[model samples]
Target: MTAENVALVIGASGGIGAAVARRLLDDNRYSTVFCVSRAATPPSALAATPGLRWLPCSGSPEDIAAVRGELGDDVGRLARVVICSGILHAGDKGPEKSLEQLDPAWMQAVFHANSITPMLWLQALAKGLGRKQHCVIAALSARVGSIGDNRLGGWYSYRASKAALNMLLQTAAVELARRAPASKLIAFHPGTTDTALSRPFQGNVAAGKLFSPDFVAGRLLAVMDAATADGTLSYLDWDGQAITW
Candidate 1:
């Protein structure tokens, strides 16, 4: 990314998202780093990281549009767009391990957070982001989303929602190819990072297999940096390895 170019990082509140935003700011390559999240303002920690400009957003159409409006003409200078928002659980509800445990309400929440919301951001930003010579829209996805790679079945809603997300991104690549052929769309899995989202599930994750947020963010950036827009969507891991659809 050029010094005059801009970068947008959605869901910059915590975990892997926060790490990526900080990494970008620390890189000092982009002229501006617009960080969006549900918080009323940017976190106190961000003040320590120079070059980060937090733009408060609720992940709504209006908010997304507001963010677009905030960028104004510089929206076209968007070099890299990374959407790191997602939900693994909320309230008392978590992923359903069995079909009987599935609740439509819970499933809907998962889909809304994991899949639909990210699309809304894409929808809002797609037009301005279309002008970049080499832009990449990287959405955080899960390997569990891979229907082909699923040998152990469970986490129905989580799996299905992420699978749906991958499909949406895949379809978006086609549209992006038409509107912005130079841009690339990616469904990126950050691996099992040590975050609240993976806290409960960490028991099964072997030692050294669980990665830190910084590690995952670094790896993801490396992959995105080296990757080219080949007119197709890519489902890849933090290691830059391709995952089956």
Candidate 2:
């Protein structure tokens, strides 16, 4: 949209989220940025930005209400919303695992963190997105989430949860097309970034395969900027290559 637009970034305490905020701020395009995270303490960088607002929320209805109270109703009708909230449990990785070794608790944790949390955010904020013009809602998803690309089969819980997230975003896109015809909803795959989430799994990645958070953030911004509210939900890699459903 322009330097005058407002952007809301969820999970702003983390690497990718923080990087995206920085990129948005540096461009001088976004007039204000809302950085939301569950962390009790705000990040130093986010807190230091002049037009940036660090919001603390537990992703509950009550917490979201509190955030809205602090930021006011006008902030809800933002031009762009980026969701970077996600988690991968310790045991959710690895190529081979037997049913006996899988922990139901771990699976539930992964699903809650990776899939359900973002859905709640969408449900809570859908109405706030301005209905008069085009807006963008982009959520961080993963390539492993692609059911059609699961050749090597691994990371059962994480993969399954992301797949669920893709479904949710796609469905949301369809509904938004009718209700808020100007808003585009998308599911994004940031590829193998050099962040805490991907550090343990980078051994097999090529030298340039693991991207910096800033790089991924920039590419994501580019993708979102190019997207139209045509009910075409995308699952794409860092290079903007579309991943199969």
Candidate 3:
């Protein structure tokens, strides 16, 4: 790994995102690990980590652009960018179980968090990521996003948002293939991790399937390391298995 390479983790206030940032810092691969999240500061556990920089972001266009500007020339040197921004539930609004529960506002919010936000960040980082050095860019996606694998047919907003995210990444991969041939894009599903995002749904997860934040972070890093810069968007699981699109 190049000593000058840097990494960025968006939504680093979350469990998986924080863990990924910590792992990257521990690996000693990146010279700096930028953690962007809605929170102004990191969790107490991560605040003391060296080589870690916390940047507050609200996922807005202005905020995202400002964060990129904060990178300055380091933008071109970014080796890894992991976008963990997504919303499964908010307050009393949870994943819908049926068509009757669908709400336009909720759907809009989910789409913004799961799809548009990532695409916005991708747009902002396109030039910097279009360099010759090998780079791996990953976005946190869910298995429920797969159109072909949908059997239960619930959580309409969440599912559709993630599916839209996959499409955005797929389309972006095609363009980046020409502009950034040395870069690889990945849509990663970390499964049902034991985080606040999954806390309410953990009861239904099968045994041996739910994972810890640290375990998922390690596996994600391993999967990304094994990925080749083929200019294709890989929708993969924690174990590096490709999921049906």
- Name the Cα RMSD for model 1: 1.2
- Please report, in order, the local distance difference test score of every candidate based on alpha carbons: 0.87, 0.81, 0.92
lDDT of 1 by residue, 76-154 (tens): 8877889998988777889888889999889998999999999998888778765447887899999999999999999
The CA lDDT at 160 in model 1 is 95
lDDT tens digits, residue span 82-148, model 2 = 9998887455453225566567778887888789888887877776665665778899999899999
Task: Provide the lDDT at 95 for model 3.
Answer: 97
| Worst 10-residue lDDT window, candidate 2 | 89-98
Residue 130, candidate 1: how far off, in angstroms?
4.0
lDDT sort, best first: 3, 1, 2
Q: Which stretches of candidate 2 lie over 4 Å from their true place?
A: 2-4, 90-96
User: Which candidate, 1 or 2, has the higher lDDT?
Assistant: 1
Give TM per candidate: 0.96, 0.92, 0.98
What tens-digit string does per-residue lDDT give for candidate 3 at 105-171? 9999999999999999899888876458688899999999999999999999999999999999999
Candidate 2 clashes between residue pairs 3 or more apart in a chain or in different chains: 3-29
Model 1 spans > 4 angstroms off = none
